[model samples]
Target: MTTLQGKTALVTGASAGIGLATARMLSHAGARVICCARALERLQIQLDEMPGPGLAVELDVADAVSAASLPDRLPQDWQAVDILVNNAGSDIGGRQPFHEGDINQWAGTIQTNVTGLMQVTAAMLPGMLAREQGHIVNIGSTQGLTPVAGCGAYTAS
Candidate 1:
């Protein structure tokens, strides 16, 4: 197994599910993990449970300003992230035909999954490039490829 001793990892949407699991794994691997999510309370709970050092930051990736400001907002010790997990996403507005779907729902999905991902990556990439070593992991669903009828908005994102 690859050991991440002394490395710092940032995981978005890390209050639950896969993001939370990944944070734990990274912590176990000896990386200091920074967990970001809108649910600050939950994130703090998870961070407290981590076997290694962890920090919890409240964030809403769907907001352009928030996503873009992530790097600058991190504590100095956690700013040079060696690993980034772009795992924040949403599936609102339930299943419905594309034409019948709510425009707002579609917009929300796009904002979170597409635009937010881009903003976060742009904010973090410069630092990684300058350092010449870093890893970015983008979590995506199989729905992106299958494109089920009622989930067009999600698939498109």
Candidate 2:
């Protein structure tokens, strides 16, 4: 296993599923993790389970205002993040045909999966660039590669 001693990682959508698993793995690998999600309570609970140091941060990646302010909002010690995992995603319209899908839901999906990912990357990239030693990992679904019916917004993202 590759050790990440003395490094810090930030994971979006970390309250559950893949995000949570990634955060736990990073912590176990020796990186201090910042677990971010819309649900602070759940995030905190997950953070407490990590084998290493971590912090739970409330964040809605779809909210540009919050995404833009994330870097500054982090504690000074956690500010110099060395790894970023852009894993927040949404499929608000579910598996509905395009014509039958709700436009509002489609918009929400786009905002979270595409725009939100970019927003979070933008917020973290500057620090990584300044430090000149960092890595970014973007988790994408198979839907992005193989077009599927009834998941227009998700596939597009």
Candidate 3:
């Protein structure tokens, strides 16, 4: 647990819940934080509700082009991130039978959870490896951990 003084960190899904908590904690610990999520409205609301200096990036991690643009989006001076929290994911439309489900719903979930994670991690990795220092925390679903009926499709993919 470092103080994070003068460090730059990016936390995905930071507009709510665990992501929000971690971002705030990191800020308190002295990290220069960049909080990213899909919902601009929610992110703005969170930003307005909170107190202090953190960058809020309107990002859709599931979008590969956007994830690939990370280097371009980073502040020139603060391009080197010391911490990356890959916490963006969504369990949309609840637990429904695989047959009855839209199937398209699962795409977004997997794209965010699996593909998006890889893209973001890959994008940020060079910087970390170059400096030989960094930490990445990924959030995974409990359903993906076990045999849940609806989760079958999501877990399998």
Candidate 4:
């Protein structure tokens, strides 16, 4: 990884798991990190303990209206994101036979895993384009590569 001394990284689903780890790693690498998730208080607690500067934001990527307004919602100083990690995803209803799966749950999974990622990226890309520099990391599951027995929605997303 290259030095990110002056960069700003925005990570989705940053309350825990891969998103949290990525935020910390970026902070350690010297970038200001914006950690976003549905639970602001929880995410803020983690951000407070990180090595470098970080901002905790409440964002439910599954909400289209919120996702569309994200760029404008950010503070002026933090708006110019240098890196974006689109890691907000869910395997709602978990593994089940396709015929036995709930359609609503499948929709939820697709909304979060696929549409949510696209919305956030679309929100942040303009700033990156204007600056002529940025990086995007879209976290994906191996289920996408190897067909799974009971994760049709997850694999498709």
Candidate 5:
């Protein structure tokens, strides 16, 4: 392993599940990590359980105002971000046929999964480009690739 010992990485949706798994892998490679998620307590607990030191920030990607302000809110200790994993995503809340689905849930689904994903990525990518080195990983569901009748809504994610 070419040590990532001095590198800094950020893993979004790090409170649980796949984001947590990715963070663990990156940390094992010797990268310093900063975790973000809407659930602060869960993020805190996950960070505590991990084998290294990291910062946890509460973030809701659906909130444009908050997402826009992330660059300025980075910790003083964090300078350049070397690795970025855009793993924050959400499921749509309807299982009904596309016609019968709840309208608000449908809209919320796109807003969070698609629009919010873009917003967060836009805010971070510029910095990575400025540094000329970084990595981005987006988590996409299998349902998005192949249709599962009831999960079309979540697949819209």
Candidate 6:
């Protein structure tokens, strides 16, 4: 059990699934947790249920403007993140082959999973490097390694 007392953790896509679970675990371990998601109401509910200190921020990582402004939007106390969990991702478009899929959906998937992740990492990296202490955890899917039929965009992302 790694103790994270006095540390702060930021988790994206924290409105549900693995992101929510990670936020709970980090909070239980004594880290102040900041949950980021597009749905502020749901995020707040999750934060309220978690142990220790927690905050909820509405963020859409897929949106370049939103991603770029995230660092500036953080409250002073939560700005210096000790742990970053890049878990904001989704499979867009219905199950379909690459050629049959919606191009917009494919672009969205890429923007969120790749470009958005990079933006968030870049936004937070400077603070981490300056402090000389931090950890970044990128959540990846087995689908990325083992391509599955009808999930071309998701697999590619």
Q: By lDDT, who's the top model here? A: 2
What is each predicted model's overall lDDT from 0 to 1? Answer: 0.91, 0.94, 0.81, 0.93, 0.80, 0.91
Pick out the ten consecutive residues of candidate 4 with the lowest summed lDDT: 1-10
Cα deviation in Å at residue 119, candidate 2? 0.5
> Using Cα atoms with residue i matched to residue i, what is each candidate's TM-score against the true structure?
0.95, 0.97, 0.87, 0.96, 0.91, 0.96
- Between candidates 1 and 2, the one scoring higher on TM-score is 2
lDDT for model 2: 0.94
User: lDDT, candidate 1, residue 40?
Assistant: 96
lDDT of 1 at 93: 90
Candidate 3 structure quality by residue, lDDT tens digits, 1-157: 6677888889898989888888888887888888899876787667664445678888888999989898679778768888999888776656888788876887877788788889999999998999999989887667667767777555654
Query: Measured by C-alpha RMSD in angstroms, how accurate is candidate 3?
Result: 2.1
Q: After superposing candidate 3, which stretches have Cα over 4 Å from the reference?
A: 48-52, 153-157
Which one wins by lDDT: 1 or 4? 4
Give lDDT: candidate 5, residue 13. Answer: 80
Of 3 and 6, which scores higher on lDDT?
6
RMSD of each: 1.1, 0.8, 2.1, 1.0, 1.6, 0.9
Rate residue 108 of model 4 by lDDT.
98
Residue-level lDDT of model 5, residues 115-154, one tens digit each, is: 7778878888888899898887788778788877765557
Candidate 5, residue 32: the lDDT equals 89
Model 5 pairs whose backbones collide? none
Residue-level lDDT tens digits of model 2 in 1-157 = 8999999999999999999999999999999999999999999888878999999999999999999999999999999999999999988969987779998999999999999999999999999999898999999999999988999999999
TM match of model 2 to true structure: 0.97
Model 6: per-residue Cα lDDT over 10-108, one tens digit each: 999999999999999999999999999999999988888987999899889888788778878999989999999999998888588677888899898
Best by TM-score: 2
- Could you tell me the TM-score of candidate 5? 0.91
